[model samples]
Structure formats: structure tokens, C-alpha cells
Target: MEYSESECHYRIKIILIGDVAVGKTSLLYRLTYGYDETIRPTTGYEYFNKFYLFGDEIAQVHFWDTAGQDKFKSIVTNYYRKASGAVMVFDITNRASFESLKDWYKELKKFGEEAVEVIILGNKC
Candidate 1:
């Protein structure tokens, strides 16, 4: 199946989840909208879009930034329902955050889309 030069379009839906203050939202912002020093906890969830131009093809990536607050855990699970990929974040400076990655991974596998690709990211910030 070959897509014509003008017919190629791609979209990827990725969810970012982790313990609070692990920089999930910060990473999303830096990747899609550039850096902002004031990092805040995502309330429930926020949507971010990043687009890449590949010759005639357009690739649009959708990033779902989920809150790290325990109160938002249930809400975050709901965001995982249709994700294509997931980025589990942790703070490298915080041991607890790193240890919690396993829990995040477990939740992703349990509630995220079957066969969803995931990568765990450790943030220094």
C-alpha cells in the first residue's frame, strides 16, 4: 500500500502519565509548545498537538497530558482508553517518583489500548 505524495497523513495519540511533580506536563509543553519556567500540575487532562511536515506528508501528534495527583488517577485512567502510545514520566531527583513508574506502567497496561507502545521518561527538572 503506497500512499501518494499528497495523500499521506499521520496522527499519533500519546498519553503522558506519572506521579505528581514528575514533569509530565512540563515535558509535553517543552516538546509541543516550547519551555515555560512555571510548571503546574495538570488538573485532570490537557491536550497538546505537535505537527511535523515530511515532504508532502503531514504527521500530527496528539499528546494527552494527564494529571499526576492521586485525586486525578481515576480521571487519568479514562484518558488511557484510546491512546496509541504512552510516555510514563518520573523525576530523576526523586526516588519515590522513580519507584512509582512501575505502578504507572501497570496502570497503562491495564487500562490503555491493547498493544499500546510506551516509554518511561526520567526528568531531571
Candidate 2:
């Protein structure tokens, strides 16, 4: 369930970042509007909005789903600074994808808020 901006108490900025084909877009779609197996590779970045209940408050979460290709790294990091939280995703079946999470975490820490909360998703099991 979701509430309009007026009904919500506050807004939150969340980012989904990871290596290419690690299912960042899939995760976002699954949670927001249902997953599509044919989801194309995100070009630069994409925006999505969903309301989640946080205790008694409904926070309008603004999601930034970033392109994970190296070519987009420069563009993607720009979205990191203001994020209140991040979902760092990796394909559980891919060892390389799992290893690259460290790099992603470092980048997020370097650019995101000092107290940004991060949750990891071992996706595609």
C-alpha cells in the first residue's frame, strides 16, 4: 500500500547500486511494481517512488536505480551523495559480483552521507 505525498510525513532517498546484470533493476521493479524478466539494462540512472511504512510513519522513498556498467560509474556516483540509504545488490551465484561489493561499498561511503544505512541483497538464488 502507498500514500500520496501529502499524506506522508517525510521523504527518504535510497539508491540501488551494483555491478552490471546483478539485478538491481529487477530488485527495484519487484519491490515497487512487480518484476519483469525482460528488464533492459539501465542506461544511466532511473527514478522510482514508493511509500513504505516505517513504524507509525510512512516515508516516501525516492529510489535511484543506477546503471552498473563501468562506463556509467562517473554518472552514477553523482547520485550517491544525498542518499539516506542504499541497497547494494549482488548475484549470489557469481563470485565476482559478490567480491565487487566491497568496491561498491567503498564508493558509497566515499560519496554518501556519513550515516547512510546500507542493506545487502544476495539476489538470484
Candidate 3:
């Protein structure tokens, strides 16, 4: 079925995961607030929600902005459990950050959830 911009009510939960300073918060703000860099990096986690109207249905996009620190890994993983999608970000100049994507994906898969769609964004890209 072709989904029109104004058709259908969908509920989506997304989580942002990546290395520290990879601009997870920035991305969230960019999409939700119009620009990411305009806001400061998020601490711990932040929540955002938006609605999309599909015909007569309303689609709700729920976002979870997570901390990129190793210390916050456990907490971050917890938020990914039921996530419908994940945005994995990394700095274009940082290869290590890009390399860590696998680990983050692995952690999410470990929770027995394979329904999540992924969007990998290289900050500089």
C-alpha cells in the first residue's frame, strides 16, 4: 500500500545510540526542533514525541535521546528494548566511533528484539 503523507496512524519509538560527542542530541534537536547544533548535548536521556497524520490515522514518533558514554551503556540499552527504530551516529573524523556501531547493535539484538530499523548517520557526512 502506498502511504500518503496524510494517511494512517502509526506509533514509532526510536532511540539514538552512538559514541560520545557523536551528536545524538544534536540530531534529535535537528529533527524535532529544526536544528541539532543549536542546542547543547543532552545528558542522561531526553524524550520527544511528534505526530504524523496519515489520512485519518495519526502516527506518533517517540524518541529517546541517550548518553554516549560507556558508563551509560547499560542504561542506554534498556531504552532500546522496545524501540521501533534506532539512529546510530558517529563523527566522520572518528573511525573508532564508527567501529563501535556493531557493539551497540549487538547489545540491542541481544535483547531479542529484531523489529528495529536502523539509520546510521556520520555526523560530518
Instruction: For each candidate, give its TM-score against the true structure.
Output: 0.88, 0.92, 0.83
Which tens-of-lDDT digit does each residue in 23-80 have in candidate 3?
Answer: 8887777776686445766668899877766666778788899998888777777788
After superposition, which runs of candidate 1 have C-alpha atoms over 4 Å from their true positions?
1-8
Model 3 C-alpha lDDT versus the unseen true structure: 0.81
Worst 10 residues of 3 by lDDT: 1-10
Q: Which stretches of candidate 2 lie above 4 Å from their native place?
A: 54-56
lDDT of 1 by residue, 1-125 (tens): 23333443888789998888888888888897799988778899999877777886777778999999999898889999878999888889999998988998989889888899988888974
Q: Which wins on lDDT, candidate 1 or candidate 3?
A: 1
> Residues 41-99, candidate 2, lDDT per residue (tens digit)?
99999999998888998889899999999999999999998899999999998999999
- Candidate order by TM-score, decreasing, is 2, 1, 3
Using TM-score as the measure, name the better of candidate 2 and candidate 3: 2
Superposed by TM-score, candidate 3 places the C-alpha of residue 75 at a distance from the truth, in angstroms, of 0.9
TM-score of 3: 0.83
Per-residue lDDT of 11 in model 2: 89
Residue 110 shift from truth in candidate 2, angstroms: 1.1
